[model samples]
Target: MSSREAINVISILGSDYSIKAPVGEEQTLLNATRMLNATLADTKRKYPTLIGDKLLVLAALNLCSQQLEMKQRHQEELDRYQEQVNATVDVISRTIGKN
Candidate 1:
């Protein structure tokens, strides 16, 4: 590993994982582990009998669903902004043509 990279040990669902991250991004890696653990905990709470691989799979699915939802919302927002920009540009073009 280069001097700009560091190894960090992050715990997720009580398991410590050694991960290599860019020097300044160690905290980001830790934060990601924390998010995973939090999700696992929440999944466990909702399904008390879920254990081992099954619980992890459910948590993974939940996270993926959340990601997809966020991406859809983001795309919707971007489309709305693009439509507004297009309208503004058309208005500007019309105003310039009238001059």
Candidate 2:
């Protein structure tokens, strides 16, 4: 997409945010922005002392937490596969040595 075509203005919590995203991804970006605004509104309503930046930080932390969890799970799977490969290699080496 062209640079100008990829830029869209998103409204969140009554604020206008200019975001650069693919043309077809405007809906996805808008949806995510809406979700963030809802989350901030809910937090403010539940806790009157919560501020905008703090709510945004909390949301960022939650996203980071999800990413880390996924990374850890992927790493565990990679480790398991490596162990299986090592075990197979050891078995083959032993059989060839015996022959």
Candidate 3:
């Protein structure tokens, strides 16, 4: 392990995992892991029978769904912004041609 690599122990779904990341990414990893743990904790509340691998899989699916939703929203926003930019550019081009 290099000196710049930070090893952090993050607990999720009652398990302790030592995850390594770049020193600068320590806080970001910690925050993401905490969110994952919280999602698993929510799953545990509704389904007490799920344990071990099943619970982990459920959490993964839930997180993936959330990620996909966010990406779609981001893409939609970007598309809207691009459309406005194109409209403004066209107006500028037309005004310049008239001059």
Candidate 4:
């Protein structure tokens, strides 16, 4: 981390946002906001009738839904990996105990 401040100001959905992150992570935060704004813009375009709270809620829900699915998949993979590790440890323990 640099001695310099790691905060950045960006525009998202017509609002100015201040994001604080590691020194080199300003671009990543900016990119994330850009993606979010894009999502909001796309949602607004598809459902112009929706406004204010409704539009924001829909966009947030869409992102959350995708995030949850990804988390579930990652959890499944972690569970499989843990099972393998446990099996290997058990085999090694038994072999050692028999000696």
Candidate 5:
């Protein structure tokens, strides 16, 4: 809705959607649509009888689950990095105190 936003059309689950995205985020929108479609395809293969809203819901759930797992993994990695930095700072402090 902002002045810098543009309408971009993306296809997912064999349907096209027109979304207003920030000018610089066209690729991100396209990428998200691609990811969703891929998830939808997988869900459809697993539940061939599902259609319409039910199929979309299942695919969205799968995507959400994957996103949560990735967020957890990313947080773990950040914690590990913080610990390493803290340890290095502690060592430096101790060495400086001895001087």
Candidate 6:
């Protein structure tokens, strides 16, 4: 591995995790670590018996749900923008055709 591809050590869920990423990926890594910790904590609180693969699965589901919600909201915004654009184009086309 190149020197620039050096792995960075980060703490997540009270465990040390070393991840290799781009130079500016520190913040992204931190954010992911934080999310994981939050998911683990929340799961542990809600289900005290959660352990092993079950914890990982629960965390993955929680993260996936968050991602899906964000994606849906983004798609809604894009659809609204497309509608506005189509309306503007329709008006412009009509105006040109009349002239």
> Global lDDT for candidate 3?
0.92
| lDDT by residue for model 6 (1-99), tens | 676676878875566878897777778887887888888889889898988678879988988999999999999999999999999999999999999
TM-score-best of 5 and 6: 5
Q: How many backbone clashes does candidate 3 have?
A: 0
Model 2 Cα lDDT, one tens digit per residue, 1-99: 576457778876567878898768888988888777776776667667766678678766766677899999999999999999999999999999999
- Considering TM-score, which of the candidate structures 1 and 3 is the better prediction for this target? 1
Query: Which candidate do you rate higher for TM-score, 2 or 4?
Result: 4
Poorly placed runs, candidate 2 (over 4 Å): 1-5, 22-49, 96-99
Comparing 1 and 5 by TM-score, which wins? 1
Model 4 stretches astray by more than 4 angstroms: 1-7, 18-22, 97-99
Q: Which tens-of-lDDT digit does each residue in 19-82 have in candidate 4?
A: 6788777788878887778888989999999877788889989889989999999999999999
Question: Model 6, clash count?
Answer: 0
Show how many residue pairs clash in every candidate, following the order shown: 0, 0, 0, 0, 0, 0
TM-score of each: 0.94, 0.61, 0.93, 0.70, 0.91, 0.84
Q: Which regions of candidate 3 are displaced past 4 Å? A: none
Off by over 4 Å in 1: none
Which candidate leads the pack in TM-score?
1
RMSD in order of candidates: 0.9, 3.5, 1.0, 3.1, 1.4, 1.7
